[model samples]
Target: MTSIDAARGMYFEDFAIGQELRTPERTITSTDIVNFACLSGDFNEIHANHEYCKRTPFGEPIAHGPLVYSIMGGLQYASGINDGTLLALLQIDAWRMLAPVRHGDTLHMRSTVVGKKETSRPDRGVVTFARRCLKQDGSVVQEMRATLMYRRRPPA
Candidate 1:
């Protein structure tokens, strides 16, 4: 492999339609929720107040939707699918939170390469990935389609 290839992960050309990538699981903790709450300044009762949640269907504090999404992003990055080959996140479409994420719920993501488009530029392309976040019980907690720009394989 060339130095350029060694420096990068998967490139735009490396992805094919229907190709899937599964990330390692991550367990959400109360501390994660608290830290996310502090960072986002979202002190909602459903996410931060146990007593308030006790009156609700969940019966306890739950994680923020954004926090789950953020963790999914981290998981994806950790998977090294894009690594240094990623250029930019162009768009996120059809983002849906299907279920609540509670503390101690382990989650992972399955990302499928759904679409690809070659740009006019020779060095880059666009790819759309359908990302799904599932909990330990196989329940889908969230789903989204992320369109991202990526570098092409460099010349030898």
Candidate 2:
């Protein structure tokens, strides 16, 4: 990976409604789940203890919802959609978990700008986007709408 300068921040003016951004594929493995489980203390049967999950309706272990959500961060950074520019995640809305994410699944993310508005402060703006995580087979695993604070490009 190339080194990045983190000094600059994105301004709300940079985004357009209907703009689409996609990320490269990311493979998820058992170790990834285990690490997330240990790091987040989310040791639920579906996410960590596979044998215990066999008794559930899904009949197998699934990834945690927040774990799936975390994928968005990787997507954002890797895709250059928010790289070095994003200031903060302000809010997320209508977050939904769909099909279960199993080990060895490949995931990708796409986001579309739904709206954008300039902030009262001249240096920043708010951007709202609809985001989705999809499996290799194109099945949607999770979806949400997010709002972020972005810094404006400095005047030349």
TM-score, model 1 to reference: 0.95
| Per-candidate local distance difference test | 0.93, 0.83
Off by over 4 Å in 2: 1-11
Q: How badly does each model clash, as a count of residue pairs?
A: 0, 4
lDDT of 2 by residue, 1-156 (tens): 986456533456768899987888898888888889999998887777668888888776777888878876886777776766788889999999888898888999988999998889888888998999999999999999999998888676
C-alpha positional error of residue 41 in candidate 2 after TM-score superposition, expressed in Å: 1.5
Cα lDDT, model 1, residue 23: 95
Clashes of 2: 4
lDDT of 1 by residue, 1-156 (tens): 644346546899899999999999999999999999999999998988989999999999999999999999899888888789889999999999999999889999999999999999999999999999999999999999999999999786
Which regions of candidate 1 fall more than 4 Å away from where they truly are? 1-5
